[model samples]
Target: MTSPMEMDKLLHVAQSCAPPEAIQLIVQVTEDPHTHTFAKLAEAPTIQKLALTPEGAPYVQLLRLYTTGTWADYLSMAHQLPSLSAAQVAKLRQLTILSLAYQERSLSYATMCEHIGLAKDLRESVRILEELIIEALYQNLFTGRLDGVAERLDVHSVTPRDVPRTADTHNGHDAVFGLLQALRAWRDRSSDAITALDTYKRQVEQKYDARAQTMQEDHAALTDALRNVAQSDTGMVARMRLQETYPDAMDVEANRRTHSKRRSKRTRA
Candidate 1:
């Protein structure tokens, strides 16, 4: 596998060279599936510098085409890339399939043939299309199955292509803007969810605290009531015991008080 580091080294070489040499190297990188980082390569200062030159504009445009354009895009460029190698052309067609699968899950054979420039008879085109699908599957470009009966490619998943920063007739700006809006919407939803969870957590904690406080108050009141009841019961039992010990004590005490009062009155007289 061609690594990002290798691609970076190649880019550095391309940048230090003259415009013609840089264009050649960039094209080589674009054609190689493992080193296909045209999105980054296209934005390099060397490539941009090349674009400023009249002779380098075509090559710069070709790099941009590889970055985000499809096979149909190449055909529509008025045969400007007549010198592109057969292998490079085929690679571009394969990348076109990836782009199609990214856009839609199900692809009919006819659609693939038209898009990939398979201008053979129906049977031959279908065969070529199947071969391309198998190649892509082997490369792990996408997860999909070829439905021979349906004559369609049912894509389960696909890797997304890099979106171009520059505006072309394909409306790259709209795509970038739409992606930004989606990210912002996801952020807002996540924030709202977090806020709701925090509120719910606080509410549950508050309820538990209040319930504990109420239980403590009830326990204290019950303890106080029990103590008072016990004290009252003890006092009543002591009084009953005293009565049992001296049943006629109250009558004797009353008589003694009357006698003492009578003697005191006689002395005073």
Candidate 2:
């Protein structure tokens, strides 16, 4: 926070500095998020005037994003704009997005590209992705494997970036809009989890059903086998005490056939 008096003093000094000098003051002040001076200069057309110069053009663009740009629009400018301090801010905005897209320490390259609206050019996409990864690594944003072969950025750990609540735009409406976005994201994730759980449950049920059908068939076969054993009595009655004594050693089912054959032979003789 800064005093009204101090803000006026800074603004007056910015006004006195001519051309590129004024641009430097504006960039330096706005870069530090602590000062509320940006809102006042933002209200005036002075920063917009800075856009006339090449160097000032970058600063003006940065100020516009600070005061006027939507979150999505702000994030998408990283690759479109030339390398400047504003581009750094754009990268930070990108980091905020990636932080949300990550899952269990890994993010697929395709998903990242989709989330960021990566350029269609394969070469450009690779260049931007490498820059993003390097910046994240250098800034200690997270740590993990950026596997080219695997085609995914696998993070082992992460620290989330803070959402900006700048003097230019921090109000109830902003908060509510942010909340709505968060809820929508949560809803999407919940739906995916439910779908996956349902799939797994169906698979388990199918396996159980197949196994149950097999058991029923086995039971039916065993019951039929038992019925055949109980109903058959071709040679169950013992002819004599010798037949009973030798029952365990006799093949009664086989002997019945041969006995008829022997009787027929005796009759012929």
Best by TM-score: 1
Q: Local distance difference test, per candidate? A: 0.76, 0.59
TM for every model, in the order presented, reads 0.61, 0.37
How high is the lDDT of residue 88 in model 2? 45
How does model 1 score by TM-score?
0.61
Residue pairs with clashing backbones, model 2: none
Candidate 2 per-residue C-alpha lDDT over 87-182 given as tens digits, one digit per residue, 9 for 90 to 100: 545454445434543434677666666655675348777667767776666655577778877777778766433333443344324534655786
**Model 1 C-alpha lDDT per residue in residues 1-269, reported as the tens digit of each score:** 24678967876786788987987786787677664446677878888898888888888888877777788788889366536776677778888998889767899888888899986457877777787789778877889889999888999987666677665536366556655775798799999999999999999999999999996886565456445645785856654554465446534544876999999999999
Candidate 1, residue 49: lDDT: 93
Task: Per model, state how many residue pairs clash.
Answer: 0, 0
Off by over 4 Å in 2: 1-132, 142-160, 164-179, 199-203, 206-210, 230-269
